[model samples]
Target: MIVGLLRSLSAKVPSAVPRIALTMKPQVIFVLGGPGAGKGTQCTKIVEHYGYTHLSAGDLLRYERKRPDSEFGQLIDSYIKEGRIVPVEITINLLRKAMEKTMTENENKFRFLIDGFPRNLDNFEGWTRDMDGKADVKFVLFFDCSNEVCIDRCLERGKSSGRTDDNRESLNKRLIETFLQCTRPIIEQYERQGKVRTIDASHSVDEVFNNVKKILDKEG
Candidate 1:
């Protein structure tokens, strides 16, 4: 399904839009965290203050799933409903297209806050191989929070989020299967390279963003 989706989308993409080449490396900072870790909130603040384009992998997939006449709509919906990560290729292709479109529309340098991506080793490896020289990961911002807190936050959010995975059942699968089994390894991988900055997400939104701003300030 993923391969077919990629081919179909590639065929539809206009060849006129230039692809990112080896010499043009965009600035990318990965935002990693479990569900309800406030990644979205912090990313909004970063975008407002740092002039970075915010790209949430989940949001990209969700948008594609809802597109009219989308070939991968059903497939994307199924994976999302099961709390499974979408195939890395599909996500990366969407991201690359988005980045290209954004860059073409604006004159500024491309600095992106890529939220909720490279969720596992497979995703990490796929991104490294596919984007090898087209983009560089400056750092990973990890929002650290206890599972219990995350669960509560997700459940509370589910009351109004309207997101399929915001409920308890899906949140459980996402927290354990995706975050613990998959995402944790990716965070550790970046940590080993000293490219991860852990932020305490149990605090108020303002407090959390304060820490995030400090890190981004230092990065700048």
Candidate 2:
């Protein structure tokens, strides 16, 4: 199904660029955490204050899932609703296209906050293979919030978020191992390389953002 979808997509759009294939060298910061771990909030703050284009992985998948002309719409929707990772090829392709599109539009816009990505080893490995040397990853900004808090926040937001997967039942299935199990290795790998800046995200938004600001200020 994925291959067929990719082929169908390629019939209309340009073929995906292979690894180390592009010339764009944007600055990238990966923002990762469980749902409602204050990642989205901090991303917005970063965009406003630091001028980084916030390219949320979840948002990109959601947008593609909802796009009427998208060949991968149903597949993406089903994967997301099941709390599963979308195919690595599709994700890397979208990320590259977004990077290229934005950079082509504004020559000076190169900084990007890629939020909620590399959810597992496959994601990280695929990114390394398919990002086409488009970016120099600055760091991974990890929001360290407890699972309970993250679930609670998701439930509260579901009241108004109008999202199917934000409710308690979905959050229970989706977020139980999102931080500790799914994304732990990626965080640890970056940690060993001194590329993980973890923030205590159980605090109020302002406090969390302040810590994020300090990290951003000190780091490149």
State which candidate has the highest TM-score.
Answer: 1
Candidate of highest lDDT = 1
List pairs with backbone clashes in candidate 1. none
Q: Which pairs of residues collide in model 2?
A: 20-132
Q: What is the C-alpha lDDT of each candidate?
A: 0.87, 0.83
Model 1 bad stretches (over 4 Å): 1-18, 21-24
What would the per-residue lDDT of candidate 1 be over residues 90-138, giving only the tens digit for each residue? 7887899888878777748589989999998888998997787888899
Per-candidate TM-scores read: 0.91, 0.90
lDDT of 2 by residue, 151-214 (tens): 8899889899899889777676667655567788899999999999999999999999999989
Clashes of 2: 1
**Model 2: per-residue Cα lDDT at residue 55:** 92
- Candidate 1 weakest lDDT stretch, 10 residues: 14-23
- Model 1 quality (TM-score): 0.91
Cα RMSD, model 1: 2.8
